[model samples]
Structures are given as C-alpha cells and as structure tokens.
Target: MTQDLYRLIYLSRNTIPGSNENIHQEIEQILAVSRQRNAASQITGALMFNRECFAQVLEGAHDDIQATFERIQCDPRHADVVVLDFKPVEARRFSHWSMGYIGYDTLASKEFTQIQQATGFDAKQFSGERIYDLLHAHLYAAEKAGSGLGKIA
Candidate 1:
C-alpha cells in the first residue's frame, strides 16, 4: 500500500545571533544538514529565510513530518515556533527539492517586497498556505527563467 502524503507549514523567529556572514554560514549549514536528513526521510520542502524570520513548508509522510517538526521546535536556532498549517495533501508541491532555500536578498527583490509590505516578515502574521504559495511561486519563476535560485541538489 502507498503511504499518504502530508504537508506542514511553519514560521519561526531567527534566533541565530551573529553578523550577516556568520548568519549566512549558519543557514548554509542548516540547508546542508536538512537536505541530507530530508532526503533520507523521503521529505521534500522549501525554506525561506530573512534575517529576522524563517518560513518553511515540509511535505512527506505524516510521521516523518511530525518527527521533523518536533526536532525543529526544540532547536536553539529557532524561537517562537508556530505551525501555520498541517494536513493531508493530495500531492507534493516540492517534489523535486529535498530542501530548497530562499535567502534574504531574493526576498528583498521588488516582486517579493510587495509581499513583505503586505504580510510583513513576522512569523506570527503568516498563514501556512501563504508561505507555501510564496515559496512555490519563487520556485516556479526560477524554473521558468532557467535560474538556479534555490536549488541545492
């Protein structure tokens, strides 16, 4: 029998205190580790990070997603971990990416600036679907432009 697919979206304050270069390195480490773990667990997802907050969408089996989120909540780098949405999904939105990443500069672009103005980067203000949509849109645009915006592997 086939396992069911589920999606989880969450936001958290970035508590990795440091200079920009240091923070970037930390995030790169996160992506590197996340890519390895998620791929091993058969999870695919996208992560968006500004210096102040992080929004991510994880898709996989229910148990795997739950386990991953639990680890995320306990992580020292994240503060105010909040799950915006979680439920069964018909399909994976990020099937190709083990862990796609969107950085601060990409988010500061004019196109995304309007989104930031409307929603703000505060983790408390976002809905899970909106976060998923934002990441999906970025991936779609990158694909269309033939750009490797967030592709890690």
Candidate 2:
C-alpha cells in the first residue's frame, strides 16, 4: 500500500525431478510476464539454482513485488516456498535494472560445477548455500562489469 521499497524473496526446492523438458519453457513465460510487471513497478532480481533448489532476490515496490511472488508461489516448477528473507530496503542494490534475466545459458549453467570445484562443495551441499553465495557474487559481478563503470567508479 505504501510506496516504500521492498525485496520479495523466497527459497524453494525443486519439484519436477530433474526434467528440463518444461523448466526452460516455464522460465521463458515468467520472463515474458516479468517485462510487463517491470513496466508497472520497479523490479530487479536474480534466480539461482543448484541441482535441486532455487533462491532468489527481488527488489521493487511492495505491491508489484508481492504480486510477482504470488505468481511464483503457484508456479508448478518449484514447491515448498519458504520466505528465507524479506524486508524493506532503503537503497536497492539493483536500482539500475528493471527486470534482469538469468537462465540456463552455457555460461550461467556452468556456474554449478565451477562453484563446486572452486568452493569445494558438492552439488547438493549446504542446502544450496554455495549456489546462493556465488549467485550474489557473480550476478552482481556481471552486472557491475556490464554496467560499463570499468577502471574508474
């Protein structure tokens, strides 16, 4: 109801049992609607996945953020939505973005194995903790790099 900034977040374990047959398509649809959602409200976020779980951070106005979460809650792709983190933010880290996208491209997908080897954690370790760490690090890294503020901030 208020115009304050909010970050909509949750973690969910996978439910489709390792089937890409529908995951990509489902993500595509989400992204499509996400653009429309972005038009209505400021939203920037990332989706992180290990072999089994998903963790995400979405920052935006309260109502639009909650509306998106409601849609994701009913999404058949993942289940057991737990609000791992949620709160208002004074300044959003992703203030420059509207609806950033990340999915199973070769590079983004390889983060799983690379994080395992680099962090010395197995794919399913730490409740997908390693993935979450790398997700924040790498996504922000990529955003910073692509933001074209190189050599001098």
Candidate 3:
C-alpha cells in the first residue's frame, strides 16, 4: 500500500532574545538537532533564514509532518508562525536532504538574482506553488555552483 505524503511550509519571525551572535548560534544548534531527528523520521525539507525571519518546508508522512509542525509552533525561537501551505504531495521536493538550509546573505549571489528580482526575495511573500518553484530553482542553482546551499544527506 502507498503511504500518504504531506508537505508543510511555514514562515515565522525569529524571536530569540539575544545578541546577533547568540541568535546565529541558536539557529545552528536547531539545525543540527533537526537534521538528526528529521532523518530518523524520514522527513525531508529546507530551511531559509535571514536573521530577522525564517521559512521552512517539511515533507514526509502526514502524521510525521503534523507532529513535527506542532512542536515547531511551540518552540520559543519562532514567533508569528504562519503556515503558508500544507497538503499531500506526490513526491518529496528536497528528497536528498533531511534539512537543507540557506541564509539571506545569498540574496546578493548571482544565482539568486532571478528570485530576488521577481519577489524582492521576501520570505513572507513566499507561499504555495511559488515556494516550491523558488526552492527547486534555488537548490538547482546551489547544487550546480557547488556553494551557497546543499543537502544534509
């Protein structure tokens, strides 16, 4: 029998109370743990951070994504968590990664110029099919350049 696969995308402002250095460190810590846990849960996704806010996509079994998202919403590090999209999908978008990541600084990179020019590279404005398309394009460019963002696997 085929299992149901679900994908969830959310955007939230980073609300960690600390210095910039501390915030960066905190995010790194979150990534480390998230990678391990997501891998075990068979979840695949990418996280985009811009110091001010975050946008992440999670894909996996419906129950797994649902449980993971609930915990994410309760995490103090994230605030104003607005889910941009949630639905069953035919396949994983970031199949090779447990949790790939990209920082806002990449907005200035040549590879990201297309997305930047189109939407001003605004994280909050990203939603639904737009987020999926942008991420696929972004990851394709990153993989081709051997630089900015990559898979955890």
Which candidate achieves the best lDDT against the true structure?
1
List RMSD in Å for every model shown: 2.6, 6.2, 3.6
lDDT comparing candidate 1 with the true structure: 0.81
Q: Write the per-residue lDDT of candidate 3 for residues 28-107, one digit (tens) a residue.
A: 89888889989889999888776667778899999999988998999999888888899888888798778877766675
Local accuracy of candidate 2 as per-residue lDDT tens digits, 1-153: 555888765667667644585666666666567656664666776665554656677777788788878888998878877775567877676554454554555355477546545646433343333444555566667776774211111
> Model 1, which residues run further than 4 Å from truth?
1-3, 108-125, 148-153
Instruction: List candidate 3 stretches off by more than 4 Å.
Output: 108-126, 147-152
User: Candidate 1 residues 1-153, lDDT tens each?
Assistant: 665899998878789987998898999899888999998899999888776778789999999999998998899998987888899999998988888877788843343445556776554565677668888988777677787644546
Name the 10 consecutive residues with the lowest summed lDDT in model 1.
Answer: 107-116
Q: Show pairs that collide, candidate 1.
A: none
Instruction: Quote the lDDT for 64 in model 2.
Output: 76
The TM-scores of all predictions, comma-separated, are 0.86, 0.64, 0.82
CA displacement after TM-score superposition, residue 113 of candidate 3 (Å): 13
